[model samples]
Target: MNDNDKQQGPDNGGSNPWMKNLLIWVGIFLALAVFVTIFNGPAQPAATSTIAYSAFLDKVEAGNVRDVNVAGEVISGTLKDGSKFRTYAMVQDPELTPSLRKNGVVITAKPEDGPPIWQYLLMQSLPFLLMLGLAFFILRQMQKNSGSGAMGFGKSRAKMLTQREGKVTFDDVAGIDEAREELQEIVEFLKDPTKFARLGGKIPKGALLVGSPGTGKTLLARAIAGEAGVPFFTISGSDFVEMFVGVGASRVRDMFEQAKKSAPCIVFIDEIDAVGRHRGAGLGNGNDEREQTLNQLLVEMDGFEANEGIIIIAATNRPDVLDPALLRPGRFDRRVTVPLPDIEGRVKIIEVHMKKVPIAPDVDARTIARGTPGMSGADLANLVNEAALMAARLGKRLVAMAQFETAKDRVIMGTEWKSLVMTDDEKRMTAYHEAGHALVRIHEPASDPIHKATIIPRGGALGMVVSLPERDSYSYHRDKMYADLATVMGGRVAEQLIFGYDKVSSGASGDIKQATKLARAMVMQWGMSDKLGPLQYEEQQGETFLGYSQTQRHNMSNETALMIDSEIRALVDGGLARATEVLTKHIDQLHLIAGALLEYETLTGDEIKRLASGQDIGRIDSDMKGPSVPAGGTSIPKTRRPKGPFGSPAPQGA
Candidate 1:
């Protein structure tokens, strides 16, 4: 439809004739009143002439007075010619009556009274009465809507979604295969509780979905309700707590009462950690309202029977802080870890999101999944949406692989800061720094393969080097850790070699910080130090909730701490020394790669490999501003088997 047609909806002016006419007449009356008031200003009092008492008596004597009226403190009279005049007089004036009578003028006396009671009521009291009535109505409405005041704070605020409205199903969830499997039994129990009852088995009271944000915990709860065709009541943990003391406990009781009435349903409390935190946490009020709510929840969950079929599913990322009583055997019996998707799971998630968008044939899901290694299900879904948005912005018919690549980079490294420009000198330094990272990772025996290297500014980094493991490795070996540390320091080493130490910039600050952290973790937490004799120096704190505890505490003695610092430094120095040695041997290749980067700004793995290979075997280009060896000058000799900084034999190419 056209714009005009769309704007003309069914509820237009002509739909109700009386209402329309009423509005029109109201507008006309307002406009007329405003015009009169603006043009005429305020009303003027009636014109009257004031005459002195002697002149009034003279007029009466001359037979010019026609009539006189005495009312309260004033006496007024009209002349024989009908010209009106009035004057004030004392009530005790005896001449007032005699003068009028002698002149044969009509005289009348009237009692004085105030204005009518209804007039006063209308003019002064009506607006206040109307305001009081409106205030009463609003207060009543607030009481009805919130169902809370001095006495009614126990009502539950959960929204009930019937089976038909529970639109999500298992088919809608992806990338969380383990969590899905764990919930399938809950669905079956809701569908046919008799099967379990006959076997003398009781289903678990509840399942707690624990994971980082965006791992699809709440979505899985809805799918269970949809799959079982049961009623779903969802509420947030904060909803149970209130400013009043007993309100939260009352809400807990009311919610369970309602759920039991609608038995064979699901109660999903999202972010349960808000109300389920441990009692006496040494923060805030000792008698916290949240603690009371948690106590009530524990009581209700324990009272419910397995046969009741009112499954409670709670989701929280901070299960570490939940009260232990709430997570006991009878309540929240199942703990499901909905972890971030692996490579294969990411591919499936991408495919699920891709089904709705128009995409080019070259948009490979596998490649995208490989690039997004640590992404959760929601992250992958957002990645697809970002790609589609990019395509639409560029006015493309379909989302292409190029858009996905850019979108991935935007998510991983942040959006490119095209406005952030650098001088030629800065650009050259960034290229060489990134090139150093790629070269070291390429030659390091235990390092992952380099994915891409770029000197373009993205987010806070002036350059980036991406490396992806060929396959997922659950455990890190000592050699691999050393290799990773050396790779991190490669950028700094590269800057020091390409430009003298004085010319090096702070771009390697992040690289140095990461390398230091890894070294410290290795010595103190991972027990990788030979001097420390594989004894863990760090103590772990208690898990806040869900029992997923593992934070390091440095509780060692002063002497031990000193030993740890020395060990960390030893590890970092060793990695840097190895990186420096390898770079020195491949200094020619490093300059050549950096030169190529200056011209291209970015390079893929294949291009990097080709550039590094080109400089080998004395294939020298004299025009290039790099080290040129004479006929007899050699490069690494290819047979000088020496240990790399990671204490492993360097790769043959290096």
Candidate 2:
């Protein structure tokens, strides 16, 4: 630690964070108190000079009243001697007025006067004013949450970032070097436009970043603005569209006008597919809010001059769905594809993310990258974060290699279902099933190595066998596909040999589905089938709007479809037969592996190989002697069963 950090004490020099918030709340409370005190004023004393009814009548007859004012049942007046008094009189006193006039006292009769003008106005208008204020507050809250209100429908909701707002330069981004290089030209042009102008070159109007989700498209756009030290205006495609037709167009104009004002600036539109979809697609109703907005956007792009300093950058995962005009040369002139990071790219990404974490010395970023084959940039970031969180949860000071491994498994295979319960028979079956897969994968030279085997329930699996390649493979071969099929069928074959056909569980349903898909792909897509020849039988039509292929059709006849199905079935059956033969030859190893699984619950590849090798050494003596002669030599002798997962005696061959 540095000396300044070490010398720091509890009484720090910086301002307290709570001081500002506390002052704001205190001011609000004081204002509310003052408002309440002003509205509810102090109380007044009662008048003590009120005379009785008879006394009031007597005084009216005696000419003591100089002037009398009758307001409701009370009479208020000034006496002749300049003394003021008030008295109560009944409404039935008809002679009171006459008596006052006979005594020569001036009398007037009128209704009671109301309160002061200020108080009166306050009573009548306060409710309406409060209601209006509440309505305005509610409208503003709605605008904040929904991004638009009745009055603000045409206002641009673009988020403006000053030059200092986003400090993310090119150095902050990694894993997509090609995309960075493609954007470097724009950065240079933005920094010094005279160099490009001298060469008679015009900067591209817009650049569209296309990639899968979590591929760092938005981050790269921000980096471009950051490196150039220019203002960045960001908005989502959905921000332009509204329920009203013209509002979308108005918002587009406002956004462009803002971009123009902040010249030498960049505007980023995220998820542009929401507003830039293909026009007249069969999807929406006849109303064209999105189309009108897109039209306005096109006009604004075309209206800009060559030397105008504004540049637009848009991001979308589905570029195929955008309007054709948006992709034209004058609009989005450049297209940059940000694909998923490869092995080396992943290693770089991991290194960048690891800087934020207190990682252990043994945590090899390159090893972690190799373990994660198909992960994107965002996925790797989340994996690192998840590892840190796991380490923190365990009360560890540093994020270790084991934590990263656990995090990778959690991201790929899902959280372990530790609470799931299984019976002894089911657990035994799961053990044998997983062990079958391990044996086939270990023996097959073409298949990837088995990394892990576990009978623990996770996600939708009662048991799992994971195979990881030694290195990343970009292409697949027919031999590898066949080996994969055999590995998939191994579990079912083991169940059939051990517990008979009826006792086999339905846990292999996923395995069968995957095996069938591979088999069909071989026949229809890969054209690796001997009977089907080297012709494509199925065609995948491109999506009309914005989606995956709408449908796949078989161009061949129904008879040919039958043949394809037959070929798929033949491939599966052949895989099953091959798996049975391998399992039978290493039947002792399979039994030994299953027993190990029931004891350990999970096994690494190295542990499985060690156990299998030890069992092979013991079986060499038995293999030298010819087996007891059988008619077909297909059946094998069964060994004594060990204790099952739930401590029950299992069947002999189980």
Candidate 1 vs. true structure, TM-score? 0.75
* Candidate 2 lDDT over residue span 114-189, tens digit each: 5678866765676576567557756865775554646678878998775434478887789899999999999999
Clashing pairs in 1: 319-545, 319-546, 320-544, 320-545, 321-544, 321-545, 578-645
Model 1, 1-654: lDDT tens per residue? 532232244337557867755765586566556545534544433655788877877888899999988887677767999888888765468767877787899988876445457645554664565566556656655665675453457788787775435378998898888889988999999999998899898899999999999989988999998888777889999899899888999888889988887777899999999899878773667677878788889999999899988999999998768888888899999999999888888888899899999999999999888888878888898999999999999999999999998998899888766656455666667778888998888789799887788776766687788877776667889999999888888888998997898977777778878889899889877889999978777776875444456767566788988888899999999989989988999887787677666655667776677777763223333444554433222222111112223221111111
Q: Residue 556's C-alpha lDDT in candidate 1? A: 72
TM-scores for every candidate against the unseen true structure:
0.75, 0.80
Worst 10 residues of 2 by lDDT: 645-654
| RMSD (Å) per prediction | 10.1, 8.8
At residue 179, what lDDT does model 1 achieve? 86
What are the Cα lDDT values of the candidates? 0.79, 0.79
Off by over 4 Å in 2: 1-73, 77-88, 92-150, 163-166, 284-287, 544-548, 615-654
